[model samples]
Target: MSYKTIVVHLDTSARAQARLHLAIEIAKRHGAFLQGVFAVFAPNPRSFVVMAGTAEYYEEHETVRHEEHGALERLFEAELSRAHVDGEWIDETGNADDELPKYARRADLLIIGQDDPADPESFVADHFPENMVMSAGRPVLVVPYAGSFAHIGRRVMVAWDGSREATRAVHDALPLLKQSEQTTVVTISAAHGNVPGARPPGADIAATLTRHGVKVTTLDLPAAKDVATGEMLLARIDDIGADLVVMGGYGHTRWQELILGGVTRTMLSSMTVPVLMSH
Candidate 1:
């Protein structure tokens, strides 16, 4: 019911500091071991095919990579020291989107930043945040690209669909939800009504959370055919003024070419608050 270790992805991006600060706060709160992972992809050999010289291309790329890694390491150390959190820094040479998930297996939770499309260089991978969430077996906390969140898990919103994925997300978020001042579980039901033999939407889960000492409330909304599920959830998050959102990241695609579910993709692309997702 508590995070023992937290792994955070670090990079030389504008929003990296915001993510680090949030991660530090969480680590301090839980008294967890904090780890900062910097995955620096080595120069792609394929790109040399178009260039006249391979040596020069690799030399320049290596230099930039080393410089970036050093900068990230310095920032990681400084922040951890200032926060006085038990922490470690890891530097790896590989595709960030791939390596990060591997690192996540050892940690109770993983923290990563939302991709900023306007800043192409800010992306850690081709699909970035989505790829990490889909691959990491553990829960992931994705910090927004624009906003600064000084506090998290104070107010929470859970998007429930009554699927196995939803169940996993709810359970995975138990520690945070239990600490939240208020937690709202929003269920999107079919327009018809409750399905046969199923408990009322959100009722069972809300009761369960109440037993766990969470200040829980339930809200039922009819699913709209024309609107995407992610849009509905985002609107609800705004309505409730939630600082954090917990939900399942459902998706179907080959590992090489990921195609995220509509809701998963939309939330990653247009999230206003931090989101904790479990696949």
Candidate 2:
């Protein structure tokens, strides 16, 4: 279970290079093809009405957009050449949240940057990472907005909850987990009721991974009062000194708005290490 193709989202953000470096490392590790995808956000024609001349203003906006696209392409090519990794570049014109998921379908894994609340304009699209995780049918690895990750998958922490999403995340991360020197499966005992085949939360999964030649350990944690489950998981990651985390992305849609589960939202907002998530 090795990644054959790795796709990464690139933009004008300063952290784009960090994300690309991480993606290149993963691609080189697994001998995978790397793809750099850049989404050019075109100006909306409706906004031209605010200007004195609608058509002329729209044309100028498009011209600037094209220039930016060309510059980004050059940057991507230079990086790829410097790394000397087998790769390709994809330039799309649209909202990143919509187009990235489409590109993700062809890759084994999708790499994206976590949104930085300090600079809302850092992302090319609104809710970019979150939307991709919800829409992409493949595993999405989100790199933190702040930090340089020189190594990944050396120590792994899996947040298991005995749910379908959690199971999918575990399976999707098998290649990485199998290669890790240490893998810990942490399950929070929060009194989930009457679920069939829910034998000791993380034991079964740990056994299954051990059968697959993974150096695995199981740790059961009790939820503390007045603390969110996601916070507990984050604390555990720090305690174990894990460089990577694998977990399920839980969310629901209400009135056309996608509302993420508390754990998923919290992790995305405050993650210090890279996280691999599947929905």
Candidate 3:
């Protein structure tokens, strides 16, 4: 199966253009319709305590935001025209955490940016990426804030643990896996244990991918109790030169991930390559 419609989140952040470029490329590759949804952090003036000049401040903020939004739409339309991509632009004014997930549900895939703590403009909402991963009801591709990725689906790494979430992620990522030059399933054996009937931890999934015409391999890594599985996966991704990573997101609740630590949370914080995640 291929992506028929892809939704991308755009904002005032510097990296938004990079995300748009990548989304256009993906749309071009898959011959899919692209939707650029402009959703940023816009706090409602009504939510604040009534004070003198509050209305004036709110009005000024909105004026600036609208101008910037228009500029971004022009850029998005220009890129779509230049690439000959079928697409549309959507202007949203609300909490990003709420609006993006709504848009994502109607698309085959959602492309978004990883949170950049150093850039205030990237703060569209609290834990935006994590929320989207859990609530989008579709696969979310998160592009790193610090890098330039001109290509994806070339070399892929799938973080496998054999849970329902992992199964869903693998299935959601099938389109890209079929196009990948090489795909590897990295299993954290000591931490997650083995799949029910597979001799090796990742054998079953690897075989399943093989059936779908994916050039696949498996790697079983033993992790100690004190070591973080996410760190291990990141190192292996670099060693293998993977450009895209597919994995389950927040197998546990967000609270559990925050308290006990989790691969999904870690990758969201420190991924070097683009990550496609599903909950």
Q: Highest TM-score: which candidate? A: 3
Candidate closer to the true structure by lDDT (higher is better), 1 or 3: 3
Question: What digit string (tens of lDDT, one per residue) describes model 3 on residues 167-253?
Answer: 999999998999999999998777775554558888999999999999999888878677789989998988889999999886435
Top candidate by lDDT: 3
Task: Summarize candidate 2's per-residue lDDT along 145-237 as a digit string, tens digits.
Answer: 887797799999999988889999999999899999999999877734324446668888999999999999888877677999999999999
List candidate 3 stretches off by more than 4 Å. 46-63, 195-198, 251-261
- Per-residue lDDT tens digits for candidate 1, residues 1-279, read 899899998877777777888998999888889999876435467778787898686888677867877887888789888878999998766788778888899889999988887864476667778877888899999998888798899999999877777788889899899999999999877733677457668988999999999999888887888987789989998789899999999886675678788889899989999999999
Q: Judge candidate 2 against the unseen true structure and give its global Cα lDDT, from 0 to 1.
A: 0.85
Q: Which stretch of 10 consecutive residues in model 3 shows the poorest summed lDDT?
A: 252-261
C-alpha displacement of 200 in model 3, angstroms?
1.2
Q: Which stretches in model 1 have alpha-carbon errors above 4 Å? A: 45-65, 191-200
Better of 1 and 3 by TM-score: 3
Over 4 Å off, model 2: 45-72, 191-200
- lDDT of candidate 1 vs native? 0.85
Clashing pairs in 3: none
